[model samples]
Target: MKQRIVWILLGFMVFMSSVVMAAPAENAAPGSRIKDLLAEWRKGDVKPATGNRLPGKVGLVWQPRLDDATDMSEAERIDCINVVSPCWFRISSEDGTMSHAALSPDKDYVKKAQKKGYKVWALVSNSFDPDMTHRLLANPAGMKRAIDEIMQAVKKYDLDGINLDFENIEEEDRDALSGFISRLGTELHKENKTFSVDVTFPGGSPNWSLCYDRGAIAAAADYVMVMAYDEHPGGSKYAGSVASIGWVENGVQAMLREVPAEKLVLGMPLYSRIWKESDGVVEDVETLWMEDADRLVREKKLARVWDADAGQYYFEYQKNGQLCRVWQENARSIALKASLISKYDLAGAALWRRGFETADVWPVLAAELENSQR
Candidate 1:
């Protein structure tokens, strides 16, 4: 009888623990959908007003080698005037084996960017935290190890700073991520390297926000890059830009409540998404490259639809009797976003990637920022 009772108690304990772990995060604001939740949060105390600053110059980022190498050119790298080269990504806790495609400053294209006096920064990710974010929530040793490895990489490569891109972490890991970032900021400061984070558009459930502690994250890093796009894609039930104007404004406002305006970098998606209606196949995706966008307009007879609410463009047409949609970025939309930077007094803008920029984007950006003080 005693043995049976003990076994039952053990099982009960296990089940109870599972339930607790599975419960939604505490203080999760109500809303089933991403848009509603974000809207409601914006209505709350997340945003704070601010004094506007001088308009900022535009900064374009290039995610090189990883997406597709066939289209990348040598000349594109050497003389991308007025662009900032953001390294694709480097992973942590692993040995110093860089992936073949991820942009490495030691690599040819990066070297070219450096030679041309373009500003550069190293992008790194534990990316969803892997074992570190979970098992190391309170594990000082593991956190330190991750930090040490990353700082070493930054120094070895002579990077300007690091871009933190950890994503999809569990909620319990939020505090740990904040603690880790605090430590990382200290280390990066010792070497005069800036630290920044890549933030998802603020919405989603407690499940999604579990990994991100906006307050702590903002406090720890020099700047936070809000990826203000990717709201809807080809596979989604609807069509939209990742960051609609309202969404972008509210998200930035949320971050501004905790982070200084000068420390905030608004991320504009230079890419677009595509979805198949009948098949429910959606690709939350990139902008049609200059070459691809041109081919579609000039060669294909599809009509482009402009998303005024979202400040993006898309195409709707029938193929094989199935509806197809393609979302894209062009000189016009890019210019619109750049104008927002000036209007909002944002620190700077980061393009989702490099190389796919419309031929006219640079000229427009340059013209807009030509006389800016910053």
Candidate 2:
């Protein structure tokens, strides 16, 4: 019971998780119940809301390799996906200059995705620098520069929208962050482009959780993607699931109190972590794709145990006399998370990044979001 309470208290998951449609209602016909949920969630959306362009199953592209040599692109699975948020832009330099290199080299990639009917939302981030974001938002010019660059990029690339992922912002700058979102959102709406912002669960670390004003954000942006993964991060002192189902559900419920279901996008994880521990103290952590996590299980022949409280499969192995454990994201776990989409009547879901999941996971997600209509 104490463990369950900690599960609910965890805030702001790290790394990235994907989100999308939820599972069919309990003991109900999937075909009918899904339609009912969709109808209810679509009651008041107007012309350019992200939900309008969704089956809302978004697969985030993380600097996918140009030639498809190493990174396996999820573009082929557009059958289950409708939009892609590429990690295309960021303000990483000390001076707050927006970098466009993330998409420059992948120009053709965006064109191809669009050609396949996928809405491409270029992701713009602050590189998670609390100090930098605080300083940048303090200067109106810096904020305008960032927003102007995003507008120029959308027009230049004919992209569908922008996914503003600003993290590590100071709690004092909460209103400033909301102001910036409102400003950018105004610009994007002028061009009829969808604008979405990424936020974490409420109440964990002050900067990550407290800095977000969910009510203001929901009013400014077309959608607010609640990142529901990283319940246990790489730097966490203890080892646990990247995102257990119970934790994610709690996060979504808490968010619904502030954000209307129609504008809330639950972000789920397509990856998992392998924790290397020495006597219960985490020493190192490795992030792996859902497929790689499966491969590691096969290679190590680790036993899979269902931790009912976690809603994930628990497995541990010894390597070089080191204790390694994982709480992997499999199809079943993802499907249960997906069920929350319908359960909550959210706008849609967005995955953290592409290429981190297995082929089997796509089918499950596609089925949950099968009724996704633009």
Candidate 3:
């Protein structure tokens, strides 16, 4: 009886080995190609993308210096150390006469990107002027012209598509805005181009300022990037880090109700805001990095505090003997945000700006995303 039992156990072990060997090696699941896209989507970086027809990877800017439009090439602008390809470059008009910090992406940039096989898109934006955007919304002819110019730019630049980034318009203009987007989508579709939009988190009804009529926007866009950060209450009083994890999750979940899961791109902030309290006055310290915060603490002997609710780190530093609380993103937060993307099966996430990422973000991103596939 013992010999028989030993033989059976050996047979079972052999069978298991055979099954493991026969199965395909662990492969990337759906949307794995866009895993790094999480880095770019959250920040609205608008860099080009590569890989299959998956969601975005990272969005990098290809803008040139205001004075010298020809200073840097697309390849030069990209932080290849942490980026995935088919990078999206921001398309802006540069005066041929004067040099602008923004890249003058004409046929040359597009041609170069296409040569390098980039998934390039023209980001049609009017965020620079909220007033102009408002005017464009009210004036049908103006909107039409704006759309036409965008289309023309698309053709001239040989772009993959267009990204609508008009901000701060009156609520009454929602319908008109919807109509404009609808037309843009239709036109882009005819040319086999994509239409994307940068939308704020729609935390359901009532809090309409922060939220949008997400349903309408989703319908109009081929891809919708949910600007999930900035939840920390700003203005008048000191607020914690923008887009605390708790706040971001609620916003993303709320947005999913109206937008298709695959079409949604989650946006995150790479930089942080610190609130300084001095002399009964609260001041904002915006866009500081984690390294800077750490150095100030260790080198400058600043006091530190962690916000449990926000899941972020902060430092209370004295610059010139002025007490200021500095808040910055950390590796933990990046990992958590990436995990959330996988949990929700989101298109991906993008950081607000490149070159501002925390020192630990990239390593954490690469490790967590790779492990998730397993």
Candidate 2 stretches greater than 4 Å from native: 1-77, 93-96, 101-105, 371-374
Residues 1-374, model 2: lDDT tens digits: 99877766553232111111343333233455545643332231223333323544454434433446323233354576667776778886534588854545266766877777777887888988888887777655566677778788888888788888999888988877777787778778888888888999987788889988898888878789999988998789899998888888888889989998888887888888999998888899999788888888898777899888888888998887789988888888888787787777777667766667677877787766654432
Clashes of each: 13, 14, 33
Q: lDDT of each model, Cα atoms only? A: 0.60, 0.74, 0.57
Off by over 4 Å in 1: 1-60, 66-89, 92-111, 129-132, 207-210, 233-235, 279-287, 370-374
Question: Tens digit of lDDT per residue, candidate 1, span 1-374?
Answer: 99999999999999976665555433233333333433332222322222222234436474654444422324444222434545555544333223322554564544555566654566765645455446544444445566777777676666666777777667655665676676677677777776777777556544354467776677667677877766663345565565566677777777677666676677776665545456664423334565576577667777777878767677776656566666567778777776666666666777767666666776776654443334
Order the candidates by TM-score, highest first: 2, 1, 3
Number of the predicted model whose lDDT against the real structure is largest = 2
lDDT of model 2, residue 109 = 65
**Which segments of candidate 3 are over 4 A away from where they belong?**
1-103, 111-117, 128-130, 203-211, 233-236, 303-306, 367-374
> What TM-score number comes out for model 2?
0.81
Clashes of 2: 14
lDDT of 3 by residue, 1-374 (tens): 99999999999999976665554322223243333322222222222222123334433322223223222224443322222122223223221011112444566756665555455665555544444545555444444556566677778667777656555555655555666666667677777777677778764222234324567667666678776666664563765677677888887888889897777777777767667667747765555666665666688776556677777776676665556765567777767776776677766555555445555676776665554434
Q: What is the alpha-carbon lDDT for the whole of candidate 3?
A: 0.57
* TM-score, structure 1 vs. true: 0.72
